[model samples]
Target: MSVTRRVQNTVRALLGLTLAAVPGTAAAAAAPEADDSPTSASAGLRDPARKEIAMRLVSSAENSSLEWRKQYRYIEDIGDGRGYTAGIIGFCSGTGDMLELVEHYSSAKPGNVLEKYLPALRKVNGSDSHRGLGSAFVRDWEKAADDRDFREAQDHERDRVYFDPAVRRAQQDGLGALGQFVYYDAMVMHGAGGPDGFDAIRRAALEKAASPARGGDQGTYLNAFLDVRRKTMKREAAHEDTSRIDTAQRDFVRAGNFDLRTPLTWKVYGDGYRVD
Candidate 1:
């Protein structure tokens, strides 16, 4: 099967296992412990944390996979009076928007494929780049690998963290890549970089998906970077005055330098994504 097709299979398995993955928080309600009680930070939108993470995601590109550069060829142009918003958000926007979209995306259907794979899909975005794709985010997974168990472990974590618990929380709570980015880190926390450690995350994500917290709503969170960009476009539209647009965009140049905080016309959003 194709890699995307394989990813779809993993998504299917996540849906199948939803009831098994959710952890019992009832114990916490009965008698709370330090880790069991959970942090207010775990379930809310923390803006300071979001911004800092955004910067990290953006800066990480220099150290990211080369594959991403090829797949999302346009992402590098962010900033400087052109392109979508730069940094991690730029990458988030690029990845989430670029791929072959999963079906039934709008919270509309029961077997909504978009709702299905979206958790893991959006959750995949914290990468410095997607050049490594699965391996970049998943430690032992190789698109070229022939081992079934190695592939399965990687698939499991992909489903676990991205498809179920983490992605869902991010969508509902409005956190972006901050939590999604942690899954890879979580996998590393297991036994080690070998198959065993990687598979631990896989199993963990699956366990979460199977849990009761999701309540069978089947709703999936879209990485909102694109939505934010849309709003940014609207805001930019209100500010457009043609004369000002031209003046602001062309405010003199250092010859070959880039402006970084470049202003874009509302039209740019439509065109950029089409080209993006």
Candidate 2:
């Protein structure tokens, strides 16, 4: 088998072994029925339809397209403080996340293209500088996306670093799919868990209005969250465009899409889309 395929198989086998080693954790419970009611007890984004809508919404904002899967090879500085924002969820080379991703990828497949960049990646961590990384770093990152193992690592890291925590917080807040998606998108744009990150924005929003967990109206709570997120974005030059909030997510709120039900249409960066 090819090296990439062997890595993929090994990762799968490890995952299977890990799951098997855990008692009573082999199977997940059946998902709850979908409910659009703001105060419904079954509110969550676990359903496949809701998950797809959430993914599309984020893609529209981040990539200006609904094809988020195609963004694995995306890499650029974009003048953001974080250097080398790349991959599916914009892991930054400067912030140590890109190094972690490369490490994970290399663990699965030694001698991979990114493996040689470990020293540079580690040196560049925690700062916004490409001093150690040259043009070849960008080329290698894009090339690595062609490998299935690399793509899987990116997906896993995106979930572990951003998606899962955001969704979990939203569920704890008694939020539906829309609210969960709001948190997920914010975490993607902002640092996932930091002093000035999504949690900070969420806390500020909570001060203004109660979350659904505290019996607040879902629409009102989400509006508060978006309001905070917009302010946060405007504070940073790289994220000044508030269309993702004002147009895309707020449009759903206006349409009463708390459940994120599809046949949905929205716009980001003045580009329109329909996800039916």
Candidate 3:
């Protein structure tokens, strides 16, 4: 067997999530079509309007509001152990993404307000220690957020580190607009490594159902993917809220709205939101 197959089998066994009812496997299936139709491929999250809807959907969960642009200055430690979850995509201080965001920002605009905090951000990397960052750092971050350049940097980094990759992977898997958005949301939250990360969740879902790329039913695969995501969130105290899955994505799947047509309504954290 190939190295990829070996890894998938190992993860499937470790996750113990084999779904016997789902048909086919990566080895047994033909490669998925590049586009289900002309409209589907171009109309996925790559479209500007659809991407805006995705932003609102993610913001509903991340900031508890659909006003994603307002979150450029948002910052706080939610006690998630990642430390200082901030910005539109919730880059964490404990995780390396926040540090990278600052690095990117500094590279773009020299002597920016947040440049001084780089040393502190690096020192606090991998743990929730605020040894070098405190209220002053928060102040500087908020100040930096006001800059148009800084906000643009956050958007660039967000697309670079999360959104673009997720959308590409989803399209490659022959997913539609909704599936593309689903992948983007998962990438925003879980990222792409470790046991509870986006990659692992996808692997577990694959063990239960083949993706559309692998000649599987799109709805079945998406439901399986959401099941893995929900279970993963429940495993963590900070990410235990499954309403994003229970009410939003699953609602879309159940409705067979694979194209993710707008005029949609959903609730997150018990707050209703609409994108028309």
**Of the candidates shown, which would achieve the greatest lDDT relative to the real structure?**
3
lDDT of 2 by residue, 1-276 (tens): 000011111111012321111212211112334555654425467665567667756765666556667778877776556778787677888777788889999999999999998998888888778976778988988899999999999988877887889999999998888888889888887765675589899999999999989999988999999998888878866677787787678877876677776556565555556654
Which ranges of candidate 2 are over 4 A from the true structure? 1-43
Off by over 4 Å in 3: 1-41
> Across residues 85-180, which tens digit of lDDT does each residue of candidate 3 receive?
778788889988999999999999989999888999999999888778889888989999989999999999899999999989898889998899
Compared with the true structure, model 2 gives a TM-score of 0.82
**Model 3 local distance difference test score:** 0.76
Clashes of 1: 19
- Writing each residue's lDDT as its tens digit, candidate 1 over 3-87 gives 0111111111011321111221111101112232332235322333432332222222222211111221122322222212211
Task: Compute the lDDT of residue 174 as modeled in candidate 1.
Answer: 35
**Clashes (N, CA, C under 3 Å) per candidate:** 19, 0, 0
**Candidate 1, residue 261: how far the Cα is off, in Å:** 28
By TM-score, the better pick of 1 and 2 is 2
When summed lDDT is taken over every stretch of 10 residues in candidate 1, the lowest stretch is 267-276
